[model samples]
Target: MSDEIAVPPRQDNQQWLRWIQAQYGGPACIRRGKRLHDALAQLEQSLARFRQPGHDDDWLAMVRIRLGQLHALAGDWSKLEPLLDADSLRIVQQLYTDLQPQLRLPPAPDPRPDVLRTALQELQEAIAFFNRRWLRHLQSLDLSFYERLIADYNRYYLLEKECLLQSPRLARLGFQPLPSLTWQSLLGRFPLLPMPRLRNETSEH
Candidate 1:
């Protein structure tokens, strides 16, 4: 986006980072993305195409309409970063540190059947503990509003993209809808604490 429409970078605590989208960067409401501007420009072309030749279908009309709606949705978007509640990440990070293997080697499957079974049982308990702890942290976040916008974008982005490209095929290629910001998807941002992997011994032939 040009500096004319550009929003200044915001100052927040070090815990927050911007959402990543390689194709268009952040939301247009925040950065006024280049693709969004291009999409808006297509409205005139769609109107012009409707007036010419044998274009009786509503395809172009919907494309224009979606573009406008998508733009409006984006404009309503404020800084969605810091999307995560403050302190959530820090606590999760500390949890991860506490779960680290530290200097000790991870448990290995033992040759004795009883020892192997005990190790496996302990590992399962640790796995359950990690999952329960992680779930508690994830459930505490409030993603209802941002996720609603993501839901809206998933519904309309492709149609608006078709407007920008002027070709449905072009719009469909390499297109991936933004996922709703669920706790599961948020895992990509905040990682899970994991128990050490069991390294089973292999016999050399």
Candidate 2:
């Protein structure tokens, strides 16, 4: 029998999600550890073929995040722990510490400008630090990990900027106003935005 597996020419987020469900979902008794490993290897190959600089990183990030969730489901922390480098891990830990409260909130129809500004500043600082430390080694590291980091920062920046521009206090600050965004538009723009979902929560979903 051929060992080769056929994959789609262009893999999208939904495809990735489906692949994950097929591998990890269903009755617990039927789940196989080897299947999870094989699926992750296939995912890496797909990522190598499909990744496009500046565009596909977010997709890659979601795939990797899903892989981590699968590993946890398989009780294979050893596989997931090494997916990110030391610096990336540190940065992620810091981000969780700083952004956990805001991330846990339910969707807000009207968010405070001061709160948004604070979140924006934190993201800006995190992005600057990430770029300074990891920019040079980007290709060597898991692109998806970096993608997740960048996506999180950028999502907050966009969300906060939108809120701040609507503030009366900042009206005369002379910053050019971005076009107004609907809540759906804002959420759609950053589909990989970090959420409060735990690892088990993702696996179950």
| Predictions: Cα RMSD each | 26.0, 25.3
What TM-score quantifies how close candidate 1 is to the native fold? 0.32
Clashing pairs in 1: none
- 1-205: candidate 1 lDDT, tens digit per residue: 5557434456352212242233346433333324443543553354344323236732223223322232232332121112212343343234334433222233332234344334333443544554565567567767676656666566667676665446889867876676556767655554443333223423221
Residue 54 in candidate 2, Cα distance off native in Å: 18
Q: lDDT of all the models against the reference?
A: 0.43, 0.38
Q: What is the TM-score of each candidate against the true structure?
A: 0.32, 0.19
